[model samples]
Target: MKKIAIGFGVLTGFLAFTAVAFAQTYTPLAPLPIGEGGTTPDTYTLSSYLVGAIKLLVAAGGAIAVLMLIIRGTQYVAAGINPSAKSDAKERIMGALIGLTLVLTSYLILNSIDPRLVEFNLTLPPVGQSPAAAATPVAPTPSAPAPVLNNGGTNPSAQPVAPAAAAPVTITSPTTAVTPLQNIINARINRSNDYSVISNCMGNTTYDLCVKTDLNGDGQTNLSDIVLFTQKGNLFDVNQNRVIELANTTAAASCFFKMPGANVHAMLPRENWNQSWSDGGSSAWYISGYSCGGSGGITGMPTVACSGATWIKAPALMNKCAITNGYMNMPFGFVYGGGSQFSKFQNWVTSSSVGSAVDLRTLFKATFFRPIASGDGIPQDEYFETDDGKLTYATIAEYDLNNDGTADFNASGADMTAFSACQGGSASGACARADFNQDGTIDARDLNLVKLMRNDVFGGSGFTPLGWILNWFESAFFDPAGYSDTQIISYCIGHAAFERCGYADVNGDHKIDNADLTAFNTGAPLLDFNSDGKVDLR
Candidate 1:
């Protein structure tokens, strides 16, 4: 009975121990906040769990070591008289201590090597809910070509070329608002007035001598056309009288020095060549009988023929006079009344006195006055008459009276005087010379034209005849001409007269103000002050 009770008690105690051990619920640490997208914990989460587990394991090992020491002490006390029992208890205690030491040492060593080693997590998010599996991957951006750094480094692949700089702005202004001074000057200077004398004498016997000085082609010898011979000189018809408009009747009635008919008998001795004869026939004539020693009869004083007698007409007389005097005859009728009577002309004939004349063809290789084509907005009459029956009645103005290529405006006293003289005259009188616009009268319009042309000429607006010619030459023979606002501004600032003369009158309304400045800024070539190929206020 005692043995049964003891066994039953032991069994009961074992059962109770087993029940207690099994009943103590192992509460697994509440899973850390679920990873993003409910996936398994990340390395950090797992590492944290491992650290907790190691701490728990160390506590458990320490508790087991303490329980073992207590049990070993009890066993040693119960076996106080037995050396083997004490020795066995001590051994068991030592084994428990060694096992605990080993477990702790292993944990320490593993933690020292890598704390994450103990962070073992068996928990995982449900299938199909992994954060990494649901994440959207990102694409990398394309890289630009690296700049070529000239340091001592390996060369890189070629890069794309850079774009070019922006082009200059092309500014434009209103043409209608601006006075067309360039066109006006071009028209005036390049008149096609066919002076028949130039055409007739071109191939004549006198051509060799005639072309030397007979430039303006009026069948006369004068200073204006002398440049035709020199080719490098300037010719300015300041008086505006080189070309004249004549009535047909007046042209026909005009008389010049002439030789008498071959049928006429000589009234005076041929030897008395210097003698004078006055004829009452409303005309002037030279003594025809004198052979004063030249190919043509000697030039003599005017003679009055006896009644029904023969008198030399003027045209033939001029030819004879030219031959005798060793000069070319003025194509205009001979001057009868003043100290000009029998004034010997020097530049007319091919006399040894003057140099040999150049051929007209060679001298005029380029026509200075190319007629603007018709329908170009300019009046047909703007050009001088051509031999093809095109009669242009426009008169060139004496705007630049000083003949300095630039219109001097108030600086030119001569221009002022002439303007005053013809300021109020009709088209038939002296005012005709100042009739710049050719409206058949010298009025405000004519003065205005002069003023416009003067401004253009001095302001370097390229409206003067010479300016137009040069521009035309450049465009025709070289590269096309280009003008800029800089050039116009440079001219305006360089010339003081331009400033005073209202150079800013870009729009011909005749006011100098902000509008002009705006026009200039917007690329008015006329505003360029010094022509330095740039546009700036300075």
Candidate 2:
């Protein structure tokens, strides 16, 4: 009876200790200030409290069992003449063992069922702030319904439809379908006053595909220009095979154009002028046996060359090539003859041609031919390719509103501010900046588009190209500034709400509840648990 009474007292003390520990409010050593309001006090969830109680119970039970064993061993030795005392000591030892086993067994069972049962979250965020605000200890809430996606993973509504046979090119006067190509051209054209020469071609409504070939200065892009362009092997085919390979490569391909210009050059598999004569000669040109230096050829002309090739001007060949390949004509003023042939092409079209006489920068656009369905029908002309090389409508409609040379989600407040400025506004030319669907208006539709792409990371993990550029420009060229802890917390809270990240909605069902504790422990690191800028549990 004495031993049983001792054991009960020990258990009661342990229970009291656990109760006190749980009831005590958590206090941070240095609490972070949130926004302009309150300090984010350290907080704990009910689940954490329960977990603490369980731990204390186990520790107390184990300690008592050890103490009982020691006492029984001592009593057994001392009670040499008293059998009753020996029996009592043995009973106490057995009881202690049984009780200890039960406590440990309960812990093991609960832990095995779910590690979260034993998990305790000590990190807490400030309350009553935006989704971007510091994280706070929140009880799990009810989960929301699963989000609906079109066509399982594919966006069928955004899929490009096949062009009708011999369909007349729709010509809306003064403007055409605001395509990715058009946007790129317009951006380049507006970047400099030197590009004024080609500004008239900005809104041309002649060809479904913009054509810049007026080789003879006839001011008309006829079939003759296309023939000349093809003859020069300038309109190279985009290697659909390479793009498909990239699509399967990884998520990075969805945003960055990884294929080198050389690979782009290799995309033209057919025998064309782009290829060297030694590999596979062009059928259009006959190789003459006579060398330019031999007898009948001119002093500077090549002896062994394509027949009648000298009759066509070099500028005409380049212009025709650009047009044939579904790009705008390369202006004569653009520097051409240095570096890798592909590099020269990129420079001539977009970068180096800035100060040149005739700037056709606005006319340059990438053309891709992607199949809509598997192994059926003709491949449709896709104007833009996503970083992953997918031919979806989202990829096509994506634009570089910030003019940072890459299209990606706007994650900063500055970007949001810019977007807000154009909302409910007239169809100013600036409309193209935020008008996602090119409907000539910036409204709810465009806002929703921004929301849809908020999580999109371009250039893959560890290397955010656009973000890096923006940061560099801000620090190096513009004003340098850093967000304070309060600002960071506020931004985090706002970001969570905007993205529907659900730090409190642990189950990801879009609600908070006790059930969510299970998900919170096991779920992906989608929230910033440690006040770091990144979304991670650690």
Candidate 3:
């Protein structure tokens, strides 16, 4: 009966302790740290079970000690009359009190250290992850945008600020482009081994072995020498390799002064005909598979006789001015112009008696006007009969501007709309002048081509391909006789003041006005490309 009473009392004390613990407010425990001390699931589990067992043993021991104390006290009270019994009960009571004290003291120490130290917490790291790795939060990896490839299509690295508007500077082969002026500077300053001398000594000037080396005939020995060398002279094969590349600026700049005789130039190595010099710097003789200076088979340098006036073949004419100058000085007040001038010049040349005196057949000789008698499907030379029934010759060289030998100019069904656009100062002299692509028609591409080239000249990021420039050159000025390549560089440099540098200035009047407006009408709905609207002349 006494044991049962002790047990009931111990259970009541335990319930009271639990109630007190529940009533007290405490800070919510932080989440259990799983990775510390190299703790593994198996170890944590074993520890958890062992700690729980120890806590249970301690609690059971404390309860047992309390029960024993209660029994010992009851025995002491009941042993009032007997001295021996009372003494024994006192000793028992002392032993029970000591055991109870020890158990309570141990529990207090553990609770004081950390209540959680006695709790069962055995959380494992995520599956397939280490505890330390799982403890840290991982961030998502970022991806990069794709690169813009170099196909002359898009320039991803182009500067936001546009490069200054300048004359066309590149000399292109089939697959590469080199700036002549820049190349010359690099060759001379760097003394690169890629170049070799092509000319012999006539007289010593600034250059070591050559005479009359003042390329521009400018007394000072300066960078202009490199530029004028290409302007005034043509490149030829010095090694007789039949494969001619660019001439060295150092040699050519000096040798170009004593032309025909001092035919020296700097030679850049080229492996094949495709890389050879095909731009205006090449001589007509060399281009025709003959000798430079008309030696080999062509005698006395075949010259075209325009009336009594004799002009050198197409290759000799440096620019549009030199090309057109042979026929007549541009009417005294005449200015720089574009493809629209084809009809204007034709009209002036045919109507004017001075122009009438010159033979029209000799002046215009492009294959477009006069296809090759053999393979060029159209055998008869294209001509324009004037209002007075006078036959005026017209033709443009079959220009494969993009190096695609297949001619882009289709003659059979040419764009009459494009032809009509060129009509202003004269009757329909040649309608195809507005056909910028020579696909035998004028469309949005042609209009956009003009806008791009025009914007390019005005310091915009409208990178018109060099091929497009060459194509436009054939359409303009209408004298199929002269070369437009090298001349175009000089023309743009000299005519920049007049705004005639871009292909957009249609009438060569130094402005983009009415003449240029024709293409915009036919090619597209009127667009304010730069969005300046009516005020934006460009």
Candidate 4:
């Protein structure tokens, strides 16, 4: 009965130990990939476990040695001078010590072979015996937001343990964009290794290597020179590989001046094209191949403006200051103008007349104009006719002033209707109406009318020719075959002004009317653009 009881106890203990071993989970933690302090945690854990086990064994051995020494002394005290018996006793002591030493040496050898084995640590129970202190749980930290893998969508370390049970997951970080301009600038500046000299440019002044110098040589820093400097007067390559410095004269963060005409626009790095504009001006440099216009369309045509009146009595009125001469930041693109000239505005697109290979379709995709406050919601970006009260009219037929396939500037049936609003409000300071009476006369009446026109304070439209000045000749002018607005205005105002005699009345038709109007209108035989009706360019 005693033997059976002992056997049952041993069986129970063995079963309990087996159950505990089976219940404990051992999850395999993989090593981190290409990271800092990877193996340190694992090594520290293993070292501590080994040190503890070794100390436990040393304590047990010390206890056993003390017990043996006590038993040996008792046996010796009981022995009656038996030398052989003493030798046996000493041998047992030595044998027990040798066994302990062998166990320690064996343990050390095993640890050296597999240091990781030492990490099998047995945690001691907490001192307080409190539930919280006894098992201070270590909550696993949530892994970092998975990084985007760079290896073509494959992660280097995270391999599936069960190939059939789990699918491979890939994570990657977003790619940063590239700047090609800096590359080009570097290459261009390296003249010793690449091309010869920068064409038309003299030398660098902190910003560019080649540039034209104004007489003052102050760099005459303007948009035109900036373009010429960067393109080297070539107009073909505008991608900036080099940095244009930020100086007092020109301090823009970026001034990428690629000619958006043909191949240049396409070959350039950035994908989208940009533009901008203001009241009487736009900065959307002309782009070719935009879907907005197909072949045979006026895709590259100049900007058409509203000349408020037809000064049939005097045809020199033009919009001089209304156009912007400086640049403005527009949500859509850019608007540059504030300094050029009166009546001298034109779009800054690539001169398609020069024929280009650059694909600027993205830029020409659209064009926009900001709304004018006075227009009640009417966008101020279309063909503007002179207010009829001002005698102005549109020179170009309305097609796509908005450049979005819509007729934003229709002058078709709008002939004189647009001029009614400004019949007498000729903003033009140019002398156009003084040739009212058919004779040459600057009488008090004509001076009074001109003075009123100048101040724009108040006026009436009913001056039938009696109260105005006459031109030295007859009639007004028109545009030439190939001349642009700037060309025409420059030629006329220079040598075309008659002496200040408001009423010369050279052709005395007596009434300051048609006869006087004829004098202002008379051309020198074959007269042209000027209302003076003269053909003298020399």
Candidate 5:
């Protein structure tokens, strides 16, 4: 027994000596690579020194743990006769293994929690000064929808569509009644094929499968066009399989084959075969890999799922209409001067017959406006506690009915009624009380109606005009400022009942009171974060 113990001690000493020698000679703990270009950190820096120290400590700890594990494992093997000794050795081995694992994986555990945890920046700011400002967080840009492409065909990104037919067919009536598929067919058939410039060929210009191929002239060329195309059973054979099967009904293929005046044959560097597209009465060029429909096996178009906000055309009178949502000054500002004001989801069709009714609520939801962090940006006076015990921006400001510096009193029922009447263009006795304090014209008055209500008049409304509001009325006909009394009054004429004209009934509850006040008094005006010519809110 004594000999065995002495032998074990010798072996342990030898192993420890070997580990130390190996570490000193090789220094296995290499400097960590850092930064974007994977360059090693400066050795003189405190962070680098600390990292080096940590790496050394971890390597030493791991070595010690492994050594202990080996010692215990040897003990367990040697103590074959004594069951109690073997069990104790086994437990010690397990403990050593666990310690080694922890030592080696400490960085990984910290990183898994958060990469910042393992990172350190010990550099201090200069004396009597704060640290340099961090980079500003940019709001994420929304991705455009992907194009629906056909199967068994290469993308015609650079290639032009086939040339015009030998006898170009001229569309007689632009408003002719035809199937949606025929609409696409007719437009493509009529477009003059320009090889050098593909502008005249208006088949899926953006190729997002949204509206460039508006064959029915509905302004929106979506799944409905493809559904109608498939329904008509006159789809262009994109895949030259000599058959227009259900498999060939890909959105990409549908638009690709029928591109007006596209020299598809010349552009494609492959073995070409001549195929013909017969749209009942006409024959056009169908390139290789496309096939005309066979007599059978044509089912219907597959059900496709598309997600986006539904836009409806509001009356042109709703242009540059500002609405107060109680909390912020003119938060729900809808500038519908034309479709050009919208950042996304613009009207595709310009027809007077198709009344585009835009969904204002959905449009605002997707927008990234001035977002306020909890208990930040808002003024102390503007803060109010909600019924749910949560503090938020005040919904309503103290109404100074008579445009005084100080708030007159809590807004009353008569005050709200008078304001509503004034909004309705009531020029008579009591309604005159609701009149805003103006120097001369309504243009000179505050653009922010809430500011006018609170009597918190500033030279400028403090709102930096964003895209939509800036160009709302920059047209040749209307006033450049877009704040003429005539324009504002004309806007208020029909929209007094609606919230569009900045009526005090912000919550749309009919009667304005304390609850309505809860939506007033945000310290700042509305924001247009993306500069997309529209006011947005998170």
Candidate 6:
């Protein structure tokens, strides 16, 4: 096995060298020689990235401090310098403390220390892919639903479909999607690609996929376009038989001769490939042997059970002689053998439609008995995806449902999105109130018929309607700046309705009133650590 891997490496290296000799355009996913050009991007400025993060922290903190100062100064001026002023001073201190609370609270919620803190599992896109576009019919006409491809392992990537005799080169963007698959397909592709330039070409599987956005919509990276191939693979004729047959489906031939631009009706899991893919589509290109035992350790073949942080397209698998460059971002190495070709599933995506009326289904589950993760099987440790032009990252923490010790969040459920709305909103946000947009104030503008009943103003008006009071305040004294949560609670001090009598124990020292004032004055490290009018740290 050792000699075979070496020989295969040398042979593969020569073939790769020959292929590179041709001056062909490659996409962003273009693969490079193993020991050659591919490298982790040095574009991330270690120093500059850190500097920018520090700057954002300073800016957010500074804004909160300024607000606190304004609030404190306002109260001090309102009270004369006598005992009243001293009392007012204490009030100002509390106000500052509250402002600090908001600032530090927001920071704690948004800070994420690590990205790969979550675990991921080897996942494959089902054979199900977007159906042929109506604008272009695959094949001369519409061919019958293709059979489950015989590729070694079943992939739910591209559904089998035939483009018209001449299909126009229409596509989608990773950030913008006319169809959902376009989004998922493109997002995964863009991240998998380690190349510099992005192109859409057929042949080189490495950089074959491309992502485009703002296609007939506002320019955004929300769409995706998949590249079929722009590279070569060594596994086309698995059995060394020139004729690609059904029986050789699980062998390297499946990846090599897997039909392009068609939807498949079956799937092959990686476990069924019988460890043949290790042979590199072609045994000639495949590595001979490695120390693969009960643990399945084979030198030349891809570690069938190795987990890769990145995900690659199946069509991509077919491009290599018997090498894989990326993974599905999981902790466990998922295996697919001969009978598990993923090419079996059919994908149907629907745009301009919603609800049960329109169903986007994957047919692979129906054709084969795939042991899809029983319950969120993909380990979900935690992953980070930056938005806002990559300026900010959405901290996602995944929980491993299957306690095989693999803790990653690969499954999606309704509960998964429960905290989604709060992902960006602050405690001061409009959520949980009439303030749906999070601008701050709960007003008639947010909801045309909004009515806030200031129970204090109701006095003796029989039964004061809730909205009636809210409506009066907005029309009479409502001001955007006045809607600050800190201000609202402060105002409630003298009011009868919103009582904080016992709640005054902000310091949790178990005391009620005066101690709360002392705690506010001291500006404990938790709430007012930095205390420049407001606070940070805690």
**Mind giving the per-residue lDDT tens digits that candidate 1 earns over 257-306?**
12222222232112222234358534333344544223334222213432
Window of ten residues with lowest summed lDDT in model 5: 251-260
Alpha-carbon deviation at 447 in model 2, angstroms = 81
Listed in order, each prediction's TM-score against the native is 0.17, 0.19, 0.17, 0.16, 0.20, 0.15
Cα lDDT tens digits, model 2, 1-538, are: 4655676678668555544453335554765443112335365344345555667668987897889889888988898989899988888778877777766886797554334345443333334553222222222222522334775653222222324474443333333345433444444432122112122232333333234334335665444543443332211111211100101111100011111121221122122112123546432333233332223321221111431222211111111111112221222122234323222223332331222211221222322223345233322223333322211112222334443333334444444555677778874665545654333556655544343233222211232222121112111211101322122222222112112113333334543334443332332122222223322110
For lDDT, the strongest prediction is 2
lDDT of each: 0.34, 0.35, 0.33, 0.28, 0.32, 0.27
Candidate 2 or 3, higher TM-score? 2
Better model by TM-score, 1 or 2?
2
RMSD of 6: 42.4
By lDDT: ranked, best first: 2, 1, 3, 5, 4, 6
Kindly list the per-residue Cα lDDT of model 4 for residues 1-538, writing each as its tens digit.
3433464476458435533342222323763221112232322332243345455665675577668767876776666688888777776666656655654665576554333233333333435454333333222223533334777553322332334355544333112111232233334443331122222122223224333232224654333443343333121111122211111121111111111112211111221233456677844433333332222312221222211211110122222111111111111111244332111111211211011111112112211112246432322222222211111111111111222222111123121223223244442232222222211221222223223222221123332222111121111111122332222222222112332212223243332233332333331111121223212121
User: What is the lDDT for 216 in model 5?
Assistant: 49
lDDT value for model 6: 0.27
Cα lDDT of model 5 by residue, 192-293, tens digit: 211101221233333232233343467654445444433322211112222222211111100000001212112112223344647786544333442222
lDDT of 4 at 34: 18
Worst lDDT run of 10 residues, candidate 1, spans 388-397
Error of 1 at 82 (Å): 1.0
